[model samples]
Target: MALQNGFVRKEGIPPKSRSRRPAPDRRYERLLARQGLAPTAGVDEVGRGSLAGPLVAAAVILPLRIRLHPWLDDSKRLDSRRRLSVCDWLVGLPGVAYGIGFASVEEIDRWNVLGATMLAMSRAVLALAEKPGVVLVDGREAPPLEMPVRAIVGGDRRCASIAAASVLAKVTRDRWMTEVGRDHPRFGFARHKGYGTDDHWEALRRYGPTPLHRRSFLGRLSEEAIPHLPWDDGAIEPRGGP
Candidate 1:
């Protein structure tokens, strides 16, 4: 069997060999093993830095018995097609369960990005049909949750479970942004997926900001005109109304 792009089994582990001992999965495998936990859920988030669109989180309970795709590194390391393929395989696994949650642009603006990200991650874990014994979160900071949680810095790259969660979260958010692009054609969200790419900035420059644009993020583009209710004599009038 071909290993996934970013991973190779440790030197002593033969290719296609299944051993009772836990394979050297990644940097965090020893940490998870030391916890005396057999089954743990990994959590990760995507789109935290986008100029538009919601922050998406995913929690995944991976099957400890089976061999995972070797290319299972951080989602950012994989291309879109590979990530989507891995996501579909993960979602279809019998022992695996996954849940997705989103914190909208409005929520991000209201609570600030970090808080909103934590909110989305918490929601994803809570939404799982069956909670795992331990939750492995991919980041330096632990989310505020009632469950016993372990936060791993660079966990998405260091932990297999967290990497799976990252792939799922990334694919889910990208698909959502593509759909949102259909409704708001001017933003070309399908191409840039709400990232502040040159294409996105050009679109913002040409067509102005959309409802999905993060107004707080527009300070750099301060000269650009953003869509908002024009105040008349210090009173804002509702659009298409008297």
Candidate 2:
């Protein structure tokens, strides 16, 4: 974007229209139905790499008959406002059951981010109104649960249920961060949503980490935190050893 007469000007090829974006298919649901799995749950987590705020997970079950909208894609593909609107719409739909869960910052520090993510995912599944026949997790590692689990690397982009879960989880965490930002306005948690941006690090330097900051991620509050797992644009690859 370029500033033109105090207004932001857009250049280069225009971004693709949302209607053109591919919608998550119902392949997973159809396959599950063939195997007698009526209600398949899709699970996804958000804020796993955040320097602050709790890790949130959501489980969503979209009925097989419901038609997924083209705009209903991966949470990462949509902006914050769009994600929030999608989540709200999904929850209100008939035959759509979803659950939201969280793991506190202290839990993240104690169990490490990956372990805490699993814990949160488990909680999300358990929170559902009724247990699903099978769970489709949006990653390589599936959380331990009583029901059958399938780990799909890009489930959110390919599975409608997973995409809905991602949007719900993302908006839930973003809203939580925004509410917490009121208590601690210096860190700008509402803006970055607890990501380790340069401005966030500067705030940590100036005011030091609040109780919400994950101690495991601090690296003694140095310029750069150790154990960098290469997180970019919310596409975090969880390490086995945490």
Candidate 3:
């Protein structure tokens, strides 16, 4: 990964040995540290591509002396079990400060996904228990904030702090969706986590969109007309009345 014009540009990484897991680069942090940017935070968001659920962001400031877990990587690269394990361990580590922020479905609908994402990122940064001197966001764009920020395109894969943020965001959001699944078992929220999976598509067609489903996202599906009771704003509420 490289930084160009304030965006993190991503390039393919060479295949790693099968026996050993690849490690995220620490140079991004080191470079900042050299410039006296101690307590730099890495921020990342998850659920942007999902068809439903809130966009969640996490910001984490890792301590200089703490050794990161070897299994850490992009959250997408880890299984559900591993992600949960890593999230649990990361939150408990001493000198690790973190916070989570969410942009609701309503917010996404109102602001558009990009705007909502930035809002979520900003909230994550502000929610941090320990303030950071600088923020490293994983993507082509950085959220607008008063503090200094750098956008690393492949930060989740190339930067350890961003990878840690990814894990935290993913795990936290996944757990939320699982609880939502329990509330609305018919939609299989736990199974697909609100992504546009075939099962989710089928559910949409069969049962219509859930109350939490993104109305804008539904237009893109174009698979079937999402059933919306006239009073329900095109999304099916889980109430008993047809």
Candidate 4:
């Protein structure tokens, strides 16, 4: 397979002979073009399924004429070092802008993961200093935004702007977990970034649940087996004294 124009083409196809395949996300491009928008923001979220840590959302606005990076793709498809490097480059770009937002564990418990994820995305879009004319979001549902919105299923894989957002969110959240790991070293947050990996599960069993763990999620587990480990209820109590 040979790469061309943000897609992989078969080896035998000559560039001149092959009919140009429509751009994977041309609908979004056409929408922006129709509106005469120079910077179209793409938004995505990470850590929605984590048993610990906050849900992180990122919104990225890329210049309309961005040249595709060879390594750019969905964040899940890239390894850690490459994702971090790309994220740094993306943040420093002249015409690009990005921001991150997070929903805390308590918010996740109250609103549930999907709702909290959307809330985080909305906050990220709002955090941008320069307002975007139109926002493109990864996945099938669009989070309500102050500006126009379009949600594309698999946008991260198909759209460069959305892919860049995914990288930013993933890298930012991973770095956050690593920093938190230093304080709570036993959880190994730096290693798994709060995902429900076997190591993370073992750590949970050993240390009970940390403040970062989603209490509502733990409540749904089999009580007979795991015992629903106790948390410091006083720490999470309402601010006013009882």
Best by lDDT: 3
TM per model?
A: 0.80, 0.82, 0.85, 0.81
For candidate 3, the clash count comes to 1
lDDT of 2 at 163: 94
Query: Can you give the lDDT of residue 88 in candidate 2?
Result: 71
- Whole-model lDDT, model 1: 0.76
* Best-performing candidate as measured by TM-score: 3
Tens digit of per-residue lDDT, candidate 4, span 1-242: 98988778899886665634322344575568687864688899999888887888888887766665666768998898888777878887887778788888888988999899899899889878788888899988888776788898889888878888898888888888877678679889999988888878777766678777888877545655463555554233111100
lDDT (tens digit, per residue) of candidate 2 on 59-102: 99998887775568799999877886787788788988888888
- Off-target runs (Cα >4 Å) in candidate 1 are 1-38, 227-242
lDDT of 1 by residue, 1-242 (tens): 33545666576565665644332264454456577754677899988889887888998887777788866778998898888788878887888878887887767878988998899899889878887778889887768777678898878877888998899898888888887689778778888889999888877777677767666667767563544422121311111100
Q: Which residues of candidate 2, in runs, are more than 4 Å off?
A: 1-21, 223-242
Q: Supply the TM-score for candidate 4.
A: 0.81
Off-target runs (Cα >4 Å) in candidate 4 are 1-27, 219-221, 224-230, 233-242
What's the CA error at residue 56 for candidate 4, in Å? 0.5
Weakest ten-residue segment in model 2 by summed lDDT: 233-242
Query: CA shift at 215, candidate 2, in angstroms?
Result: 0.3
Backbone clash pairs for candidate 1 read 4-70, 4-71, 5-71
lDDT of each: 0.76, 0.82, 0.83, 0.78
Q: lDDT tens string, model 3, 1-242?
A: 87655767677744334655567867888888999887789999999989888889999898877888878899989988888788888988988988888888878888999998999899889988888989999999898888899998888998999999999999888888887678679999998999999989888887887767887788755644555522254432221100
Q: Give the Å shift of residue 167 in candidate 4.
A: 0.3
The order by descending lDDT is: 3, 2, 4, 1
